[model samples]
Target chain A: MKTIRLLTTLKLALFPLALQAQLELNATASFELSRGGDKSHYFYNEIHEGYSDWRFGLAQANLMAAWPFGGGWRLQGRLLLERKQGERPEQLRLPQLNLQWAPQESPLRFTLGRFLYPFGAFNGRQLPTERTFIARPLAYSYYVNISEKAGFFPGMGDEVKVPADGNTLWGSTMLYYGGYAAGMKLHWEIKARKAWLDAAVVNGAPNVRTGLPGSPNWGITSRFSVQPRHWWKQGFSLAYGTFMERADINAGLEKMKAYRQALIGTDYLIGFGYFELSGELIAATYRAPQHLPEEESFAGKALHLKALAGHGDIRYSLPFLGGAYLAYRFGMIHFGRIPGRTDRWDNGIKRHSLAAGYRINSFLLVQASVSTQQVNEKQWARRQQAFRLMLTAFY
Target chain B: MLRMAILMTTFLSFLYLGARQEAPAVIPGPHPAGVSAVRNNPEAEPVPLLRGDNEIYGLIGLPRPRKWVARGHAYNKDGSKVMHSDDPMAAPNRNVIVSLHPLDFQPPLSPTREAAITQKDQTFLPCVLPVTVGSTVYFLNEDQFVHSIYSLTLRNIAIGRRPPGEVHPRKINKPGVIQLTCDIHTHMRGVILSLETPYFTRADADGRYRIRGLPDGRYRMEVFHLDAGKRMVEVALSGGQALRQDIDYTKP
Candidate 1:
């Protein structure tokens, strides 16, 4: 709350500069209503009142600004506020704060401070106004059975079995849910930006949002993409580094650095004549536990425990409206098996999402969506499915 | 009230001319702040469509056809478009402006004319525009969003924030390529081809064009395309004869 107040004060102080055109300012406000399905997800996009009752979730607002200096330099920041049920209800987030130097007609650009980890092709389009759907990609939102503090829980004894979903200690994403990390990033580009190479060194790996103190854990991420044609693009990315929290490192573990996360991903995008299709596939592995409970660590027989995830979505613009579109996405995340277990480490989850959105103007958008988790078909049938209605406004 | 009356009059006149399937009467004058042309100069009178019989008629044929597929122009059974677009690819060589420049003949400077570029559907309508050096152009926001229309080349014409249903005007005095863009929508782009030449007209969907009322003279015919840039060809018109020139981009 103090941070939020400070950010508000900072914005108030900068209003005079914004009015003078020295600062480009914009904001996005969103309200969401959801019903059915599990409501315990982190970020609480699926919060619901009852099985038969619709529930209101959030009144989220993001204040964004940029200060463009002469000679192609800029400072960017975002302050996010949301009223909802979550780990930090009603708490604001300062996710995007960065300084960039991109000289005009230059092939290379540099950025520092806290910024979006340049990992996936879609990382840059995290704002609701820029995307077409209400439900985020499951690959980016789903938390695995890995404890952010104690590490992966699969192939372990009952003492360290992974807790339920939404546990603060165990909730982690393949991409840290697009977290803005303290980092430095750079990109080299050419051919009207048809091709580029982006690389970043951040505080921690993308899967776990934890970092060791004193720079003991640093993640290096890189991506290379090319658009050989106006309608097609392809890229590949890789991230690797020691990512365990200091707590896990101090837990009598051997070779703590070996318990890192390494991920490899490839993505493609196709857009032409009002139709857009994009997809990415990523596979990551948390190096095997060097030392743990004899029964929990499979007697030191467990190899690298792996997770494979991907998502594909397509959007078709509706010609009748200024910016109306319908989109469908399918995503899945499946885990590798333990050394002695007859089943995979975790349930292989699949989700199918359908959404329709209309941009009333440049500043406002309305979206309605529904999604079903196929892996929990039986359990989730209690709520039937999840439906979401959202309104997003920008100024 | 006078400004409002002029706006209403202009709107009514535009409707009247549009109803008749004829182009509106464009009386251009020099911008008062700069340029050499006077508004009432005798030489700046509206040229007849056909003073004599001297004219240039031709088609601009592209060397190769674009590799574009037919987009959605039909509707689905569900009342939605089959595809998201209402375009079937642009007509060949569209938006290219053709003008004739005389080597030794200095035509009278142009006076200002009221013209407009409407902001609609996240784009600047008439993406390509041809204007005189001193014409007054208005940027109108027809969409339901505010647009910050600006041109780095015409930096003096400052239109900070143009809300919907509002119109902002600027008198362009310099002669050069003025590219306009919206700060809100980076994909939206427009170009104002400000030429000093008096005889200028854009090509039609069929890549065909016609320019009339050229006095007997030696001239340089300039073909301008957004992608192919500008090219010059020399020609002479005498005896009020009609000249035919076909510009083929495939050839040198």
Candidate 2:
């Protein structure tokens, strides 16, 4: 309900852009089929049912429209609906409603309202038409040993159970997978249009993906990219903010700046005719509150948490064959340890993904991928695997 | 005798201008290979197709370049020949499309057939592909990445890949120039010309073009190239007279 209200408010804010100019509409719909999840395993979500059988459905639909409301103001909006395998029902989501003010002769652009604000380099192309694979990178989709509501607890005690159901608390991803965060962003082109810098301030921790802007904490994210040629690009990113909203179990929200999440990253892309290579490395640390599951109501001491994640991909377009390419990616995530013990705070994870993609033309694309996840913690499952096929059509 | 002489002179002058008036769409600008992806591949650009013995014939002239010629460049970091390529730019006079349309609204219906522009090696073959009006042009993908072919010049047409190798053919009924480009690869481009009249041809090595099968009538000729914009001239043929017209690049 809160998310719906937030989307409505965003719609009303950007609705004025629809009043002028010729509305240009674009749409892309996708269907997906996948297997390899169980009821107890932490699937795409930390605290959700991991449907145990082969399942398929309309994976996603995006209806997008743009209006140049003259005077250097243009509005772009997308209404999206996504479905997963199990319990979660399909709901309409307004992931983007950005109003940008860029003049004909200016090198700078200002974008306002809810958007997939650029905290990382990959956020720019989240749609199926733009993405290369059927599944998201584990850095974004894989659940980590951090919680949005209950924070983090190191090494479960005898009173705690694995896959705790009653608490509704588990590890969450560092960044909300595809959630659009409301913010005002400024973009500047420098170095003779060869480089670009983007900076934004959002409602809360970039890792928190809620559509609502109820968090008292504000986070700042920035990234700079340089393109020396058509086939090469490099980028660096940084983000910092108070991530925890509940002060009762966390720290004091407004005054305690130490209870925050800070992230740094670098990414690069190189396309050398027949093949392309790309990769990103991210490092994040958190000064988050930690408490025992049995110690119900206390603002426990802060725990220093750190993580490093990196992914590399290489794609090759076969010679003499049109619109057929094979890609392989390797990714890994490692967590920091507790202060007094040699044990780590969360599970160390790694994933391998391989895919084959073909662009039939501009209007349609198809990709099939197989992915495997491995956890290095004794308390968690050792290995999990999934296979997915996706079809995307654009009009 | 003086009146007869004056009538003869006037008659001769009218015939001179009328014979040369067959329109050519002459466009003059930087080579399209410098700006857009069209006609960039010179080493392997397929020659434009044409009819043999034709109706209208002429030599198309473009001003010799002075200094600035934008070219495709490839330089390896280590300056090694093992991983470097030197892509040549398309010649200006080649790939020029010249067509004749009847001044009267009734243009002779040209035979239409299925034509294809193949996408291979991340570049389009035959950068300039011409077909008759209402011809179905098939875009075949021969490279590894998904490539979409769309043109915004005459019709807003976009073809997606349903099958890996071939796409469903799209018929182009409109008579004009269409700029084809891949949505995935911005660097790959091609052009398709749909002609309403049956008489049209491309320029030869010496900047010449010819057309055939017209029935002694007023016609409009159009000439277009990536570098040359568009040029138009009105032509009047009478008593089945073969005409010679020259297109100039100096006239802009």
Candidate 3:
């Protein structure tokens, strides 16, 4: 209640200030109808069930207001609203709010409040309309656990599982240079808890008890992108974080050390549209004391790589219609063997995909694609096909 | 001496006859009190040329074709609607019903149909096109499948449409060279050239164009192809003059 009162008061105070300045509101929404094979199964499922889906969602509802003080001091604030679906319908949250100050056309900027953590290339620029793929890459979306059920709930002892959706929040400040061209940016964020690590462990583990932390105990991530030339774009990203507060009674584990991941990617456009290629390689290492009584070590690692090639549309501006293109991609993920162990646990997966699309206009798009995946063992092989109808509008 | 005097008299008589031939109407040289004498000379006044500008803009209409068999459609040749069949081996027909003409050249007020980009073995139907600015383009995925469209040009915008009766239309706002890509299909591609001015005309099937209604002026005419850059030619047009020129893009 007090938080609501404070928010109302802040709104009243800021409303007048916003009116004094020229404030602007920009919003976007997407209505998508999609049908695809099994949503819960791996990408390589041989036979799958199709289901109809409808998502009426807002990409952004941003209120931006800026005011100028004498002698070059300026204040700006952005209130953003974003939401995503979880296992439950009521799992909605506000993802951003920040107040910024720049001293009169100065190159330096300062920001305060809850904001996005500048970690990966996609994190900073995850606008829905800007993405080329109907869905984000599997590396970003897959293995992401958005449920509240405790980590150990799937297996062992009886413990009431708690939903861990909103366990982590982070604040970051960044200095950015180079407009759209080759530039550098530096950022730092301190998360409320290391919830991501907890989720990763629970999702990766084959068998684990219930009542584990659903959210990260605490962590931080950083990334950078560099465009050396007009045609060559490259980027590297790194995330190092930790999770604490373990309640597993059998192992008597209290806190585990963090894990780390490094990613590098490059894209090059060659010969106008004759040929183009892009690839990304990610290496992730996990470190935490294995709570087993016999083994107390902290070391595990994984490697993932994805690549795509495109031949630009050759037929454009037909008297009646215009533009078409074809593209293909191949991806693989491998899990490294644990230290002091030689057994290969069949920890690898490969995916091959083919897709084609045509542009009707600036406001509409239609695409269809088929992908096949192969896990380490043939039993897990899967073939999947999807068709998407998407529409986006901007004013 | 007598002959010389006769010759002089004859010359004087000719000179007098020349002077008497309408007395060279020169009443006065200049009148400073009234109007500017310079203005009275028609040669000193300039003719005002007409300055007019007009824009031609229209929509490219593509009525759905009859007797069409989309990837998932079954059509009857007897002019009756038939139920769509689930024949996996069925090949969708590529009979596009659209007109591809420059804005300056209008078809003789007669309904006509033409096939645009065709999905032959999963490729774009037309492969290339020459388009003028402010022209609306409609992309009908003539295949029995879906196609995702994207472009590399900064001004090139993409719109997505699926096959089997899906139509997507877009307007090119900028003039440039661009290539379109399908994010979904790796092998499907198309080319488009957004022209700056509407004074462009596409060559017919025989690679010919007869541009009319051109005012007398000098213009730099350019020809382009999907696989080539622009080839320009300079020409002058006069009133009631038909300029003949041939553009051959077959040269390297």
Candidate 4:
């Protein structure tokens, strides 16, 4: 509530300044409604039962304002207000709120405050309106346990197990893939507007259970991209971070509190005529729990986990229809297995998606997608199929 | 689960059918500023069709096709290897303007015939435009926001701010190229060609052009395109000659 009030006050203050400077104030609201179904023994889209009913997927609004004080100084603020119906709470997020300095004749820029993480295209894809599909990429949606005790399976202990359907976190220990981060960033364009390099240091990953501290945990991310033509671009990114939180890993053993993660990714995009093609590859490595329950650890051995994920898609515009397109995507997530590890949880999964969308105009879009997910291992040989339809409107 | 899938499929089918029934006009794609030869919009109001007695119909052949630049890696659909070609693909030279110099002939109508250039989705429709010397061109703001249309040509004509649904008309008193731009959108640009003659036509994607309503006599043909700059040639037409002039405008 206090944060909301502060944001509202800041917006009110910027209104007069906007009028004085004759600046453009941008505001848009978007809504998404979708439904999906699964057909596997263990729910297709989750770690537990694989079924989720129809729901209002997302409702969000974006507000932004920028003011330039000549001589290379500019102030800009952007807020994202989201109402996650059945997923989480209604919250306000500051995607970008910073002061920037860029010399009039130079390509270098310095920024401070909360800014987007310059790791990969996934980190910057925070809005549903900007994404091509209803479901996020494979790596961005995967979940891993950060607890000290051995993670529970479907038929674990007497404790009640809840279905983890794209949401729900055990504690501040686990990690949520890429989102927004706060820190100082530097950007330099090397060769005109064709190439750029960016580096930033931000508060640790999205495992912020205890809230962001003054200066305890920090992460570093960097990216480089080159656009040789007006319609083509390619880039690479890297991120390394550490999270320090205290949690009881095992009941009978001492608690483990520290963890680290690293990532390397490459992305490519091209648009020619009425067709577009894009793809991304991400490889991540993270530390395993130091102490685990006797029966939970794989052969009572602790080992780091590594995963490789990638996705590629092709979209073609229907020449007959002004703003309609058809797209097909293929993605896979492969998890490395430890020596003598018997658990199937570390197996690989692949997904194939086909979607069609029509943009009514500049502010409205309707899309439908059908996808199939299958595990790589034959022991877990079950295929799950799902379908989703979404309508998004922005103003 | 099967029932739900069937229901969703039915709903989507209905939506698709409904959308197919309403074919909306789309804004043209973005182009580099001040490139008057590129017209990316085909949905704009069609040009008045040419139907009369005499016509000049022929393909404007290029001496050689423009070569495609090999930049960063451009992969094929299968992601195997980058597709490279030694020669250019089919039909390279497009958007070339073919006109005749109006020396002795007079235009049929006054320049009062008005044509519109609209602002939609932050892009100026009909990026490459041609009109008679006295024609009035109206710049209409069809977008949701305001746009300032200006031209820095000879006299520096500036049409202040035009709000949505408003139109600003400008008269062309002389024959010259007037480059139109928007102060708000740096990428929004267009060109207004004020020709003294009405016998002007743009070439199709296949480099074929046809200018009708020409009298049977000798005339000078002027060709304008981005790649080859400008060139002129002389041709004569007799009774029902059906002038077939294939011009290879590429410079040696």
Candidate 5:
């Protein structure tokens, strides 16, 4: 068949290349079990199968390979396979691939291919051993709502819904350098994006006509950290982005406009031994054009502040353990939204968490913690408590 | 008597000249005299061997101990204690040590070609350890858990496990830090410091460490604490010299 000749030719082309080069492969597998609590209804929702009690799934199975060229040029690829309950069978996804030219003694490098967007600290620094907690920060989970009818009609419609997929594709370039005692350095990143939607919908109908022709967006972000000569340690960070979409119609209306957001934050650490204090404050705002009955308008501006302070327990590590025993953290968070904006609502939540952990060995660890959260308003607020145990090992 | 006195004078002159030459080098600069002398003599005589100096210096270099401890207790961080003691039948106040929790204590040191393995209360004793390359490390299981020792790096010896109260010695020829973990108890972990030189020591409870018997010279000294990696410090020693250094642990 014609397929046989194509396969034979493809193998011939790859055979010689494989024999002449060195290939390095690495893989990781993780399993996780979790349970969610419900206030208004049973824990089981439409998304759950017959089991409302507990769910177990394969969290990650990532495989990666890299091939080096003659002069600091290399090709790298990675494939991630994931499987969970209430989803399709095993699915394979390609997350990264690019031609990288990192010379031996050059501060500047280039990559031309599909690569991760170098936007913030989270996206750029993602190694299993580097993260502080088991799960990502809470800011990564905040959702957005989009009207499906508006998506379909382009200008006017009413079925508001949330998107399911959240990953965005983009190309980026970055520069960074730093070392100990000399203090921290700064980072500069620029990215060109080809997708419009980067977040999942919280509660809304499906929007089929999300991206139209000529709808391209790009973003630039920069961050810097400095160790000032002072009694306390200090750090500051800021990020800004804008997205534009071309006018398009799904049912009857034409949708056109640009969306933007800005964020700034700072943190400080002071004291030592049994009593130490650390806190961070952040403020963020988003700007977007909304379609009204007679004319288009812009609304929906929000801000949030979070802070935490804690003391350590060094009783157990006193004479010989050579390690600290326990530490308790208490924190509060407040959310505010502009009046007349239906996009987001704020009730100002207060949270308190007490965590205790032990390092069993250099590469192994065990920890147990309990947290309680309370909100101000009864109707809009919910009180919850959680206990968690975790184990992690790395090289 | 005259001949004897003449010969004695000649010997005395030779000794005086030698003493003058051995006087520490004094570079006409702002540099410390000891530091300069050490730099001038790279292959000078080694320090005289001393006995019964059981006291070792300990140093712990950490930016914020409270923060790290809290994070560790909450299971957000990693590292274990260097000592533990809590058993009904165990010796009173006898401390049990563990190593190999963090990426530290590389190139472990052994008293002999054979290293000691401590097992107590279902845990590996001395969680972090360093050993000279090509030496044999014995794993004596004192706990109930059946423990297995394996390293991802290439080692001259094969990987296997030993049962409780049993001793298993495996030769490690390769020079590199190898992580040891137990298959039965996933949480059981340790480090094997396979080093090229036999002149390394683990920091004590206070994070103080000393490597003796170094010849007179200027050495690029490096210290690796749990929170800090190999921090470099320049040190100089003279013939039969004793040097003291203090390293501050800081977070990166």
Candidate 6:
């Protein structure tokens, strides 16, 4: 068959490279169980199943492969496989595939292909296996209505709907949700003893159509960190980007009038002894044409709307507990009403989570968390609570 | 997914083509050129050993530090006094470096050997190690997580991180005491003592040391200790004579 011939050709092509280069393979597998209130939803709707009733979730696996060759070149790729749920169908997805050239002696480097956004700490620790808690923060996982037909306010073309079973809204997710984009990045760093200044410029948002090499949108990220004394490190970060919404692209829309989202955020991380504290604050503005329908407007003719979100968390390790730790996080997301809309129509959500984890061994971990979420509007103000337990293994 | 598959195919093809071509690895040139003429010839008449009747043997005694008088009281967890005074025998020892250098003795070339300093449970095993110059020390990580071992005192360069079960080797070519620290686990600290002379030994926990295989001659004995400080003395040895030199660091 043609498929068999192609497979044979591929194997032969990869055999030599695999043997010649230094390759490393790693994987993480997890089984999770969770339950949520009647009206709560999963922040990253594309990833998680559901959170309504007690459900025995299926196992999820992420496999990564890295090949480091001569000339400071490195190639890395990750494959994710999980069960089907919600609008996200079961499938094998390549979450990351990139090549990097960072020489050990140089302060400048370049990366290309699909790589995680270097905006904040969230992007740096995006994988579930690396996160301290079972769930992601609201600032990185919350959903906002970007549907041209139905906005987040009242009297839109179609009224925005929330799943009765407490599932995430069907809308455009946050930029940090599964933050990966296909483009190029230039990174630079200057180190002085224990301190460093890191900066980068890249095509921030994912444009599925106008993929690789370059995109219509771009962003910048920078961080400065220093340790004044032993056992302590503190750092701050600033990021800005303009994101394009592919779903809203139309032939009739003008380039300037095309719907696009702009974001600016500041973040910080501090670690001392057995304790670590980190937080981030972000503001996003979405602009549309002035000729849009009144149903999507704030002042009935406004062209832009802004949303503000913030998150903070603290974690501590108990030295006597062998490898046990506790973590707490608080997050809030606010959506401004259409320019002309009243305060009552504004949308927001607040979440608080407490989690504890025990490392059974280097490869295995057990974690449990309880979280509660509250909506802003009185109609949907029922405090939503959820409990989650996970067993994760990395090898 | 299709795009990724295409990308992978393209990358594989490129790699295969590159491999077929003469792609050479980049290796830096030799160290900076320096001109030096040999001052001594090994093929010439060898210098005879000390004209003595017998081999010289010696014992060096190390006295307790005088400033370290037992004063602190030992207490139990309940705030009750357990001991009236701290253990005198527990006073710090084994911190001294003793070396014997002859006025005309040229240290023979010593064979280089490899040694390992292991990382287990986020701590370094055998916290202090002494190795001859030109010897290589391999830092092995036994723990699951990655560990970074660096010495800024001598080389001023970070060796970077090594994963579990991996070994990172560094050849110590200079004679100096270097302190190693882990960037991730700040509590972990280690020391590597690189010595130029083969006739050197560190004192034991009881302040006793012995350096074997010395011909009958006069030696300029040099002693360096972190707590006891430094001391120097000239010792003359005759054939088959057992010399006993007791050093009282308490006065110095």
Q: Which of candidates 1 and 3 reaches a greater TM-score?
A: 1
lDDT of 3 by residue, A226-261 (tens): 444433445554443443334332233333433222
Summarize candidate 5's per-residue lDDT along A1-395 as a digit string, tens digits. 88999999977876665555565454545444433333211111111223234555554455656665435555666565644222432866555555566565444345544344332334322333333233322232111222222211111211222221242111000111000001011222212111111221111001111222233433333334333322244445454443324333222233332344445555554422222344455454444344332333222322221221111111111111222123344344444443444423333334444544544545544444454455555542442444444554533
Quote the lDDT for A10 in model 1: 82
Candidate 4 docking band: incorrect
Please identify model 5 stretches exceeding 4 Å from their true place: A1-24, A40-52, A68-70, A81-93, A112-120, A124-128, A144-215, A227-238, A243-257, A266-282, A291-334, A339-350, A353-370, A375-395, B1-252
Q: Which portions of model 6 show Cα errors greater than 4 Å?
A: A1-20, A44-51, A82-89, A147-169, A193-242, A246-252, A256-258, A289-302, A344-346, B1-252
Q: Write the per-residue lDDT of candidate 2 for residues A99-200, one digit (tens) a residue.
A: 878866677778888776676656765777666667666667766656655566653321243243354444566777774678888887776437888888
Better TM-score candidate (2, 5): 2
Tens digit of lDDT per residue, candidate 5, span B9-125? 575455446434433222233422232232222111112232222222335353332221111211101111112224321221111111211122233344333354445554444
lDDT of 6 by residue, A1-395 (tens): 99999999988877665556655566777787777776655443223334467766545777777665555677777787765432232666776788888776676667777666555556656555567777767666665655332223332211445331243224444464555566666565555335555565656432122223444666566656655543344556565555543223222334532445566666765653345567777777766433233332222333577788888877655423435567777788887766664653235877777888876644677888888767775465554677888888876
Name the better of 1 and 4 by DockQ. 4
What would the per-residue lDDT of candidate 6 be over residues B45-141, giving only the tens digit for each residue?
A: 1122323343323333565544222221210011111111122212335445576666656665462344446666555544555566676666666
Q: Give the winner by TM-score: 2 or 6.
A: 2
Candidate 4, B82-190: lDDT as tens digits? 1122211111244367877645555463452446566766655655566777676666665555555556452334553455665545666767777665533433556
Provide fnat values for all models in the order shown: 0.00, 0.00, 0.03, 0.00, 0.00, 0.00
Ranking of all predicted structures according to TM-score, beginning with the best and ending with the worst = 2, 1, 4, 6, 5, 3
Q: Which residue pairs overlap in candidate 6's backbone?
A: A40-A166, A298-A338, A298-A339, A298-A340, A299-A339, A299-A340, B54-B239, B54-B240, B55-B240
Q: Which stretches of candidate 3 lie above 4 Å from their native place?
A: A1-17, A38-90, A101-111, A114-116, A144-220, A244-251, A257-276, A289-325, A343-346, A356-367, A393-395, B1-252
| Candidate 3 local lDDT, B36-125, one digit each (tens) | 222121011111122123222222122222211112111001001112223211111111111122333322211111212323334554
Over B1-252, each residue of candidate 2 has an lDDT whose tens digit, in order, gives 489458645754553353234212212333222222332322122222432233678888865543222221211000001111122223345667777777855643544443556566556665666677777665555444345555645433545331234433566778777777654454456677777766667777577876665666778888877655788899987675679988887676
What local distance difference test score does each model get? 0.62, 0.63, 0.35, 0.57, 0.37, 0.55
